[model samples]
Target: MRDVAREAGVALRTVSRVVNGESNVNAEMAGRVHSTIARLGYRPDERARQLRRGSSQTIGAALRGTGGMWEHTAEHTARAAGFMTLAASTEDDPALYAQVIESLCQRRVDGLMVEPIGAATPYLVAEVEAGLPVVAVDRPLEDVPADSVVSDNAGGIRAAVEHLLARGHREIAYIGDSERIYTGRLRAEAFRSCLQEAGLAVEDASVTTGEAGPEMVADALDRMRRCSAPPTALVTGNNVISWQVLRQLGPAIGELAVFCFDSLENAELLAHPVSTVNQDLEGLGRTAVDLLLARLAEPERERQHIILPVSLSIRASSEVPPPPRARRRRAHKAQAPSS
Candidate 1:
C-alpha cells in the first residue's frame, strides 16, 4: 500500500479509500491508484483492513461435520477468497445449530453460509431480517426466504432413475434422506415422477426415507434385500448412505446396481467405482460467497436463488447385466416327430 501510494503520488488515506472502493477519490485519482497498485503488485493486508474496519474479515460457514469432505472443500474455498472462516457442525440438531449461529454472531462475522440441518430457527430469521447477509448452502430453510446456493436435486435424481431404466431395471429401490431436508424431498419427488412417467409402478415397499447415516443405510439395504422380489437397482440419496450400502453389501454388491445423489471421497479409487450424481461443492461455496458479498455491497438487491446443475458419473457398480428374462432363450428341438 505504501509503495502504491508513493507511486500514485497520493497519501495513505487516499490509497485506503481507493482500495476499499470508497467514494470521494475522484475517478482519475482512483484509476491512477489502481494502475499503481497493478504496476507494484501491491496486495493489501486483509487482517489490517479488517481491524481498521472494526469487522472481522471473516465469514461463518456452518456445516454438518468438520471432518467431512464437503466441509473441508468449502472451508478451503472460502479461505481462498480472502476471508477467514468460522466452521461448526450442527449434527442435524436444531438447538446446536442455533447455538453455533449465535456464537458466530457474537464474533461479528460479516456473513454466514450455512448447510442447514434442521428447520430455520427464530434467531436465524431475525438475523437475516436485521440485514445480516445469510446464504444457505446445499439446503434452504422451509419458512425463511433467503439467498440459497444448491444443486438441482430433482434433476439429478431424475437422471439417475432414467439411467437405471435404460439399463433394463424395472424394480428400482430408492433410499432417500429424511423429508425434513429440502434436498431429500426434491430428490424423492423426482424419483417418483420419473417412475410414473415411465409407466413403472413405484413400489412403496421399496422406498425408504429417514436419516442417511451408515447404520440407517445398512438397515434400509437389509430390508430391501429381504423383500419377496428384491429390487435389481438401488439409488441412494447421499454419499454417506451410499458408503453404508456398499459396506453392508460388499462382496454381494454386484447383485444390485447402485447410483447415489452425491459422490464419495474415494469414488475413483474404489475396486468397483460407484456411479453418482456429483455436486459442485467448490462452485457452490464460491457462489454463496459471491451472493453474500453482493448483498453486503448492495443490501436492497433482490434476493436470488442459484441452483447449480449436477452431473452423473457412470461407473462399474451401476453397470449391472440384464436380467435373465431379457436374454434370448435357447430354442428346443422336438424329438417326438422322429418317434
Candidate 2:
C-alpha cells in the first residue's frame, strides 16, 4: 500500500480506497493508482485483507463440462456483483468433485455454485452447516442440503414430444445420455411416457442411451431404422448427443422429424435448421449467483430450488415429415414375407 501510495503520489488511505473500489475515490486518482500498480506489477493481498475483514467476498464454481458459456456467464455475473470468482471442471468425476470443493473451501470463499456431477455429497453437509452457502446448478445434490437452479428436464422432453407429435410423427426414437445421470433419466422417462400415452410402442432399440460417440449414435440410428417399424421421428436428450446424431444422420437427417432437448450453438445455421427445447442458460447462471448471495446474507433461509421453464424453438427439421420414398420403403419392408 505504501509503495503504491508513493508511486502514485497519493496518501496510503487513497490507495486503499482505490484498491477496494470504493465510490469515494475520484476517477482521476483511481486511474493513476491503477496505472502505477500495473507498472509496478503490484497485486492486492486479497487473502490478508479478507482475513482482517472476516469475509473473503469470493465465490467458487464447480461445473460439469471442461468449459463453456455456463462457466463464463456465472463468473461474469459474480464479478459484476463485486465478488471474485474461481471455477473448476469436475468432468462428472466424483474424486475430482471432492478435490475441487476442498480446494475452494481452503481458500475460504463466501459461497459456491456447483453443477453437481454425482449422486451423493455427504461431505458437503458439514461445510454447509459451517456457514458456506452452496448452490447447485443443472442438478441437485442428493446427500447434502443446498439451494439449486435447474432447467425443467421433464418439461423439455414433453415439449419436444408434443412438437413431433403435432407434425404427425408416431414412431419417434430417442438417443440420450446414460439414464444414471439425473437430467438424462428425466428426459428419457418423459419421452417413454409420452409415447405410451399416444399408444405407440417404445421399442428397446428405439430408445438407446449410455455412450455418445459418433459410432454409438450411428448404431442407434441404424437400429431404429432396421426395426420392423422404423421411427419416422427422433428426439435427442442434450446438445452433445444432438450434435453427434445430426452429424451421423447427415443428408438423411431431413427424412425424419428431429427435436433435441437442449439447444446448440449453431443450430440455426445447420443445413436443416434444428428445432430444440431451449433452456435459458444466462438466466440459470444469474439465478445461481443470486441464490448463493441470498443464502450468504441470510444463513438461516430455507433451502430453495428454482426450476426455470423451457420453450420449443421450431425449425425446418422438426416440422418436416418423413420423405415419401422413405415411408414407402419402410411400409414395403414391413409387409414383405420372411425368406
Candidate 3:
C-alpha cells in the first residue's frame, strides 16, 4: 500500500480507498493507482481467500470479442451470481493475450474465462495451481489441466458426412480452414475417416485445406472442379468457409450438393436450402459459466472437460441426388479397366 501510494503521488488512505472501493477519491487518482498497481504486479497476500469469500467479486473474461454472444451471455450469468465481469479481446494474438491476462491478474480477479487461441499457454500453470479458477471456452489450454468447455468437433463432421452419404453423394469434397487450427484439423480427420468407412478413397481433390481467405477458397474450388473424379457434393469446414464456397460457386451453387459443418445464418433462405451443423454457442456460454462458478465454490474439485453436442439440419442443398453426369463418369471410368 505504501509503495503504491508513493508511486501514484497519493496518500496511503487514497490507495486504501481505491482498493477497498470507498469513495471521495478522484477518478483520475484512482486510475493512476490502478495502473501503478498493475505495473508493480501488486497483489494482496490473501486474494485467494478474499475472492472465495466474495470480497473482491470480479472475474476477467479474455475472448476473441468482448461483445460477442458468448461473452454477453457469460456476463449476464456472472452478474446474476453477484460477480462483476471484466472482458477483453485477445485479437487471436499471443502477445496481446498475455498482456490482457497479466492486467487481469494484477487486478486480482477471482477467476478467468478464456477462448484460447495460441498453440500453448505456459504462463497459466502457476496461476491455476495458486487457486485461480480458470475455465477454457471453445478450446482447451495446451499446457494446463484446467476445466474446459468445447463442442464435439468429430461428431459434428461425422453428422455432416452421414447426412450427405444418405443423399447419394458418392464423391464429396471438403474445403475448410487450415489444419494448423485445432477444430480445422479434427474436422478434416473426421471427414477422411467417414470416407474410409463408406469404402471410398480419400484424395487431394476430395479434401482441400488452407487459410480461410476468399482467394484461397476460390482456388480450392477450381482445383476440385477440374479433377477427373470431381465431387458431386461439397462440405465446408466452418461458417466462414461455407459462405466463401457459396460465393465462389455463384450460379453453380445450385448444381452441387452442399453441407456446412458450423452454423450458417438464413441457410434455408438461399437459392438452395443448405444443410448445416450448428454448434450450441448459448449452451457453451451457460455451461462454461456454470463450470467456472462450481470451481470457484469448490476449488479442490476435479477438473471437468465438457463436450457439447451439435445438430445437423438437412435441406435441399445437401439432400439432392448427385449430378447424373458425374455419377456416369465414375461408372464409365470403373468399367474402362476391364474393357
**C-alpha lDDT of all candidate models, in order:** 0.82, 0.86, 0.85
TM-score result, candidate 3: 0.80
Prediction 2 TM-score vs. true: 0.87
Writing each residue's lDDT as its tens digit, candidate 2 over 75-147 gives 8889998898888878778898888888888888899988887657777888998989999999888778899
TM-score (C-alpha) between model 1 and the true structure = 0.79
Candidates' TM-scores?
0.79, 0.87, 0.80
User: How many steric clashes between backbone atoms does each model show?
Assistant: 0, 0, 0
Off by over 4 Å in 3: 1-54, 325-339
Who wins the lDDT comparison? 2
Look at candidate 2 and give me any clashing residue pairs: none
Q: Could you tell me how far off, in angstroms, the CA of residue 219 lies in candidate 1 after the best superposition?
A: 3.4
Off by over 4 Å in 1: 1-54, 67-81, 326-339
